[model samples]
Target: MGSNMLFVRDITPRKVNFSLRVKVMKIQIMNGKGYDSGKKTLELIVVDEQGDRIGVNIRHVLKPKFESALREHHHYILRNVVVVDNPVRFRSIHWNHETKLMFTHKSTIIPFESSQWTGPEGFNFLQFSDLKSPVLLKAGVTADVIGRVNSYGNIKQRGQTDDIPSKFINFELKDLSDVVVSCTLWGQFCIDFYNYMKKAGEDQCVIVLIQFGTTKDYIGELTVSSDWNFTSVLIDSDDVPAISDFRARLLELHANDNSVGSLAPMLTPPTNDLTKWFKDVKCVGLDDLRPDNPGIFVVHATIIAILPDEPWSYIACKKCNKKANTVDKNVDLTLNIDELLALERYCKKCGEKPKVQLRFKVSVRVEDDYGTASLTLFETQIQNYFDKSAYELQKSLPEDQDQPDELDELLGKSLLFKLEVSDFNRDRTYANYTVKDATTDSQFIQVFNEKYQTHKAGDDSYSFDVVKESSTSKVTSSTKGDSTSTTDGSQAVDLTADSDNSPLKKRIKTEPGTSPMSFSSSTNKPN
Candidate 1:
């Protein structure tokens, strides 16, 4: 295909010759460094028809002419190449001489028949646990690794650095031995991994191969990241036998692992900079929150009103945490009553009959001296705030009372809410603040008291002060409403003046400061 094109094994240093049917294994864009700083060069790895491999250096001036014609795993033909000695370090191929392909005046590249070439059978995959080997840690050395992705982190950029133009994806990968390591993919590798994940629609059971990756010690831990301009990532390919086998092992692990808690972190949204956000963040009043300054922030406020008219909970598919609608049993009328009844329990969200769980989802108005804002809490956060599970609370109603006593216990309590401020309105104020987490964590309370100079004993009108046992003071309602006492003797304040049939009006009798016994789903089912 080229004038006197020879096999890689036949090439000699200082002699000018071409190579034929060479399959490209790797290509890297090397920018200027040291003496060659500011110049852009191309380093190519190719294997000849005899399975012998060698590196090819394309000088900066010749890049515009030949860089685009070469692609990894593709066969190519070259002409008039000058052979030279291999680099002293980072030797990927066992060859004494490498090729230097210059502009057409000295060399040329041409497309060749790919079907006739036998490329690499698979990557020389290195185990994650063995990444710290002395031989693998040598400067300029690199290796390949294949593992299953276990977690995905947010994409982050370098701080005020112009030399690096791309962001990195922080991912957690686990090998067959179950050892886990944190990996970062930079630049195009990050973008390509995201695109592949998007196309796959789900990240589970994904096996990834990172080629020519280098390892480094980050904060006393062994970490692996892409080598500058060289590493390529392959994900979830049916043609790769190694990846296919990993998929089988992953399925087996999932089947044998009965603990659902191990999988929850993967389904939940990643907590963004938890320790940093907590340490540096100060709890502010509602009025002090600026919608223009969008980020995750903390707020301490007292619940002023609960919208009892709205849904207080949701039926969610256990697997995906999505709102689920019960399937219609009429479609399966041909089945017996028992079978048809079972069919009705299926969830539409996940397209399967997963065991459904009730999750608490409530909307309420919270207020401070400065302003009032709407707050919404989902199951996990609500459970944290009330210190009771939705199932437990739902089953706590007495035979004479319709509404559970837990709802009344939550009213008037001051809570620290971690809010995500996003989606500003036309007025420049945030349209909504999503409640990420709710807690009575002592650290939060300490921070709030230090900032506002308020005692832990609630004194403000909105605060729910624990009534002293000796004091004659009684609970007071901020809004004009009829109070329904629970069986525990705690007042259930109903602000819905128009709600004539509100079960919140039910009152249970008990001595003050006495808490009712916690109920579970097994105790009773709520209508």
Candidate 2:
């Protein structure tokens, strides 16, 4: 400890005031305050060099004197502050007493350089293993976590109070040891994180730092969510050495020929049963899809139209796959600091100003002889359908063009889709068919061939050879022996080995301006 540093444990509730220099870990404004007050009550999480943390609340009247000068993650010198017992309900730190910094005419505050700290200060990040530790399992225990995002779920609204529902995004995170944990961001935290990923450009690989997060039971498993108004999120932040080291570690792993897919198994892969699951389902034609019936159905269709001028993707709610719009549009954007302070008045679910992210929202029109319909496809299915990530497709385009040809290439390809019908409203008059999964497997292709009978031997039209894949083991077949079956329009049909056994999107495209297409099947050992 520095000679001038004051230990937090030594501070006790007293009538007389005291002074201490501490780093402001975070500051959050409370909600429901009128904008007229010049001073706004704010909560602060501060820590000493010894890693001791204490909560601090600046009274509303004293806020004007200190709020503008106070910056998070910065060291501050405080004078004439009273110490009191921490309110149990609002405690953000473990310390027994909280500092009450007031704005007396004589009060003094000094902002010092960040270089004063010898190393990363004020954070005690726990490992994924720590979530199950006995101490953390006890009530009121909280800590920080740093990890790489493995996969993210959709953002959804959860009812918190009778009046307002809180928004959340569920995501899986992995620590350096490759231990995976489920994490959810609540309220504004969800909005902030979703928007952060959008602007940062780096997707799954970026390291994230979570502070003041608390643990809870989710689906009978331990999970973490941002503690109200206390938790802070930083994505790919280099200010912390742990984050910087994590970035280097990822680079090193990639350099060593360790692919990010090495962690793919850690993810709960789509089950092999998905094939049998698809087989047992009855297939429906595009015209047969009805708002009158709400059920999951299988459909073999070809993309007939790509909606023009629509950005093929958007950042969606991790849970719902709906566009994640700003949490609040009512907040005044003209004022600088006051607008930020005003955000605290709304409940976490309503959000002060939620951020929108980019997720896949591919809209395509599909058709069969029975009928044609428009369908919406979100991230997971889109990734499966295209064999590419929405982020990759989005980034590959030139800045001037919003509609990439990569998406345009999806047109005129035959696919089998698991369609889900969910009514957006109660009437069911406006139900939409969402593409749950899209694949070019033998089963779907055979169904298309049998139902449509669009392909003929004499015609230059292409036909897919039936492929039998076993769930438990790898399978391979040769293209050399099948040359006689392939027509001039038929390209080499090589089915990539997929360990999960989910069919890959291998479509037969025409040679520009021609509808004639062909498919030949050759399989390789599953990778």
Among these predictions, the greatest TM-score belongs to: 2
Clashes of 1: 5
The residue-by-residue lDDT of candidate 1 on 280-378, one tens digit each, is: 444566665555666656777777677555456655566655554545624643443234324445554457877556566666767665566666566
Alpha-carbon lDDT of model 2: 0.54
Tell me the spans in candidate 1 whose CA falls farther than 4 Å from its real position: 1-21, 26-42, 47-55, 60-72, 76-122, 161-166, 187-203, 234-242, 252-527
TM-score of 1: 0.41
Instruction: State the displacement of the C-alpha of residue 247, model 1, in Å, after optimal TM-score superposition.
Output: 1.6
Over 13-71, each residue of candidate 2 has an lDDT whose tens digit, in order, gives 55445567788877777532444255447677777767767777666766677777888
Q: After aligning candidate 2 to the native by TM-score, how far in Å is the CA of 23 from where it should be?
A: 1.4
Mark the regions of model 2 whose C-alpha exceeds 4 Å error after superposition: 1-5, 12-17, 32-39, 88-123, 139-142, 160-165, 187-204, 219-221, 227-230, 237-241, 251-258, 263-527
- RMSD to the native, candidate 2? 17.4
